[model samples]
Target: MSSYLIRNAQILGGAPQDILVDGGVIQQIGPGPTVEADIDIDATGLILLPGLVDLHTHLREPGKEDAETVLTGTQAAAKGGFTAVHAMANTTPVADNATVVEQVWQLGRDSGYCDVHPVGAVTVGLEGKELAELAAMHGSAAGVRVFSDDGKCVDDAVLMRAALEFAKSVDGVVAQHAQEPRLTEGAQMNEGTVSAELGLGGWPAVAEEAIIARDVLLAGHLGARLHVCHLSTVGSVRIVRWAKSQGWDVTAEVTPHHLLLTDEMVRSGDPVFKVNPPLRTETDVLALREALADGTIDAVATDHAPHPDADKDCAWAVAAMGMVGLETALSVVQQTMVDTGLMNWEGVADRMSHRPARIGRLTGQGRPIAVGEPANLVLFDPAHRSVVDAATFATRSRNTPFRGLELPGRVHATFLRGMPTVLAGELVDQGDLS
Candidate 1:
């Protein structure tokens, strides 16, 4: 790869400076550059941030390839300014074993789009009965440190406790889906007036809060780390805060959708608004935003779950419970956090890139833009605005809730190890990696 200089961009979360990249590392970042490069990007009005890292992304590969492959999902991730995304382990074969996890890791390496860290399944087939080979998966070629039963909840308290205890020895964290299955069975939307009026079974907030309350205490008891996924309720935020007050080793993430949209969108009867731990009330949305602002939430993750059109374009009760998030995560954050005065670009970097990287224990990622740091970077035009067009996305699925919605701050370019994965807001071709 040739050298490049990103000149005049406001380096978010860093002192004002210019950055020069050579040999896939940031070589110099200062006021004046005596060096020349093959390319020099004029970034006069843009903000430069570390390439985003997502701890929760569902790149459905090795099985649900029709919905998303590592290539397409990471391409979308690049478009959203991500340099790495931890791929969830909820595929058809279930990435519970070393072979499957390593295969997925190799595919991401071969795809050459973004760094893909495979998350191991917390339980065998996510059954919550038998523990998957936690130590083996952690020691696999994938070097998986994050384990989760994301699509299914680890509802059995005894099993959850055991998993937490086992993870403590390996220094791995267990991310829980945090839904009480018995309480949310057949539930179509958030448990509130809307669901009641729609005559749909409500998924009560207590269901999620109940599980989180249990897991944090379990983590405290076992001296293990815990991560809560896609926290969507106000009550859940209070529990996480209380856990932190007790100094429990717990971290939680909120989805971009939960931060911006609400269950009232479900009145459209559009499946796009349907998601797991379903969108809650406007009050819950405000609480999530405040939690994110006040540090009660650790990060903002794109639960970028993809599904085929047939699965998502159906009735609300039967529709899939996710949206394609990789392409819109940063834009939504820019709208909800930056533009709203709730956070600055530095806070955005911490939540979207730095903190998430730490959570997944990604060593080579989320570094500050400086000499000798890896050239994982993004040039963001905060003033830019556009409507989200799902048909134009790089992912195989078009299930985003933000379709036709106007969002701000487009990603101008994203560099992964000094190679342009996205240039001028468009995905560049990644040559075949044999």
Candidate 2:
């Protein structure tokens, strides 16, 4: 309903160009546009990219609204320059059926901040014993194309094979959490010297690798799409690389935390550093970074699990295993990947926007920044730097591990289909569209 002219923004970190948006689509791009518009944004010294897309995010709604709701989560996503995100299915009621998945989908539709695609659960209650109503959920109005038991692993070989087969029929992907529960039982942190000195239970890398190895083989055999969620270990990276070598439809994601943080931070005894497929050794982090740069890793998912302060502010062993990542994802990427000279902004857009959108089979959200494409875009000031403050975050939860750390880059504005959900580094109220 509104038209905009973004002036002198660097497209994909390339030469600067002025872009015009009208009727929710990009209308023109050049040194200057002849068309008039309601709003004109000066984007000098900023990089414009296709709005980001997260393949893994936890919008803790339906039961954990105190932690995060679709509205708040998507607002956080907008703040992070993400125009689309896949909501993981590990909710209180568990999005295992059409009714629940559709409810989540409708909530996302109402949010109006970003597109929220609901991920259906792989098994009922994430029990891993019986496959959930995958076909039914896929056919529902939610139209879930990705299924996962994210907080839990679909460990049963027979059931996992069955899920892969079922997803194949629907042209969907099965995203596996890839942790062996038995091996990680009572695990408090990454299994390493830090954990040994901290006197915490160690979560061996083998636990995650073994599951990925088995699932990749199963997917290869079934000829179905398999996505490894929050893949953390070097061994897991090797497995995914080999799977891709075989030309299997196997893809893997590395979390922003895994890319930037490490088990050494766990020594602080801070619960914020704790996470599922927990932060690994420096060697693992370096390997994950290289894998991502080389395209061995498909996308950079936030896995933005949020927990109430009460849940994360206690002793390390009893604290929740996650970090609030949505708001800080891009800054972390800029610091870890771009500034390190390991990747350029074009590569960042590919890993964060294009690949994730393709992996989730999303439409209209990850298109190129060209005339006639949907105007889902982000303007970022890479030169800007600021100290992290969780208090300023848009998410309902304040569990970010980057709190107090200075991070590079900032999202100056984010447009969703030509409407500014976030402008001048602040959120715009779209009003209730539900």
Candidate 3:
């Protein structure tokens, strides 16, 4: 292992301090006399944070490798300053059982960029018909702790109840996509004044809010852990807040795209702006941000769905619904939350790192930057700004909605277990493309 000395970095935006990382752990932190190491970084104006964690990322490997692979997706995550991400189970083989989940988990281990915890599918084939082998996946080598049918909804009440029971039995959590299928049969974008003007099929906000309301009630009745994924509507936020007020075991996450983007982008007729529980109204965007800052929302997830150009670069009616987000999440958060004075660096660390890790039950990835703790860290220059260019990103896909938008902040370096996965804003040990 290599030793690193990061000099005069602001830890969690507190007083500047020198941090010494050795043997995969933080060895010392404070004003130091002088330290010798294999690498010395002059971090005079950088903010050092506990490495970011994503509770909801779509790494389309095993079957959709043309879109993304575990290796490339984790590389993108490192560039975004994430040390751990929970890979959503919405792939070709649909990681519902032990064997496939284990395959994805091993691929993450081999990637060496960041930690990837596989989320098992809540239903077989995500059809919402039969419950998948939840306990078996939890007992597998992958040790799956989060289950979700992300691209689809588990609308069957009896089946959802059983899944919740299974999660409660194993101390895991069931993450719901929160969309009522009947209400959103052919939804193209958010249902509102914009949709009316464009003459496109609209996805109603109640479709999401209704599912979240039912799931929150179910979780309260069962006393089981439940997590809402990609919450976008103002009504959903109010319901989640009410659920927390009642002391239910319910937690919710908002995506970085939802925090900043709106349905107004759909006016451009670009499929890149389309997403599941699609980009909402500006009012909903503001409400989601306030909820995230006030702790009504628990964490920030990337929902980092990737798709080939053939899938996305088409007519709106036939285009795929997603945007590549792993490489741009932190920058989006900084623009909408920190720079707008809605949140500080400490709140950013909690929402992006500590809380997401806790929701995923990950013990090693989100530890604080103190002596004897694992040195999973990110050094970010908040003063830096850049216009995004998807062509230069590490991910395989180029469907980012922020393609030419100027975003605040940049990741200088990211360390996973004291190893530099990204250094000086470039991927370390980038091997063959073939």
Candidate 4:
């Protein structure tokens, strides 16, 4: 069996320690060497973290390979310190069935970079009409346990309730996109001072809040698990907090953009800022930061939607609603959360890795970085700073909003199951894509 040793790395940015990996599991972790290893990594200045888990990511494959394929997306994920990411089911054919989900899963295995858990669609082709084959997907090789109508919402209450009911039978989570169709129709930016001045149709905060309220109630009534994706509004946070106070099984995530940006950027008319669940006010940003700090938001998901230039490089009204995030998620989180003293690195691990894995029902991920745990971890340099350059990304698409912006920290290396997928702040070659 292959073996490796990480010497003198900080455990969650703490004091230095040594970690040994063998047979795809952590053999020992201590202040000194426990066993000899074939590969030695000098992690003298690295902060060891459990490999990140993103509950929401768009790997536009099976149709839009020009934007992002499973291999390229996983390459981006490994560079971002993620050992596993839940691929959103918003492809051309849609991953509502077992076949597509298994294809994506096998692609991840072939890539050998990160574990890609497929989120089966909550509706057929995301039509929001009839339910998809959730049970069959759950039993597929992919073992899909998370379902979402991500780009769209399940607007019908009856259908929503039914989806949640069926989800429980298979121990699955229904991640609602949480946008009221009527409320957000023709939406451009947030319904606020900026968007009003810009003369674009506003995406009202109530649109998101109303759906979250309905879904949480349905999940509570049905005793099913519900996850709110890319939660944007302050009202949404309040509702999630209230639902959790009521002991409802509702968890929410804040995207990297939502945590650090506001809709005021929309004034620039840049399509890169025109993400769905449009960025809200600075007030909303602060509220999201507080909610995430206090655990009102269960995790920090990338919502790493990728799109080709032809789709994104156009007028705001015609452009796609997404930004490539897989490469910059950790840095953005570090800047907005850790350096700001809103959260510690340990808290970052829980929000980015542990809790997300638990929410997605991913058994092989989010385990504690201890002896006998799967050797899935990332070595991050909290002190390193670099300018964002989309040209350097492993992802095929260069839709990153952080381009030309300086970001703090970097992922120096990543290990998945005792194997190196990235090293020296670069991807470790696993052969070739073609």
- lDDT assessment of candidate 3: 0.93
lDDT against the true structure, per candidate, is 0.91, 0.93, 0.93, 0.92
Minimal lDDT window, size 10, model 1: 425-434
Ranking by TM-score: 2, 3, 4, 1
Summarize candidate 2's per-residue lDDT along 94-139 as a digit string, tens digits.
9999999999999999889999899999999988879899989999
Per-residue alpha-carbon lDDT of candidate 4 for residues 1-434, written as tens digits (9 for 90 to 100):
56888999999989999999888899999988857898888999889999999999899888989999999999999999999999999998999999999998998888889999999998999998899999989999999999999999999999889899988998899999999999888999899898779899999999999999999999999999999999998899999999999999999999999988888888878898889889899999999999999999999999998888988889889998988998899999999999999999999999999999999988889999999999999999999999999999999998888898999999998888888888898898886211
Off by over 4 Å in 4: 432-434
Candidate 1 structure quality by residue, lDDT tens digits, 1-434: 87888888899934556789888899998897888898898888889999999999999998999999998998899999999999999998999999999999999998888999999998999888989988888888899999999989999988898888877887788999999999988899998999999988999999999999999999988889999999998899999999999999999999999999988998999998889989999999999999999889999999999999999888878888999898889989989988899999889989988989988888999998778999999999989989988889999999999999999988999999988888888888766211
| Poorest stretch of ten by lDDT in candidate 4 | 425-434
In the range 109-193, model 3's lDDT, one tens digit per residue, is 9999999999999999999999998988999999999999999999999999999999999889999999999999988999999
Lowest lDDT 10-mer window, candidate 3? 425-434
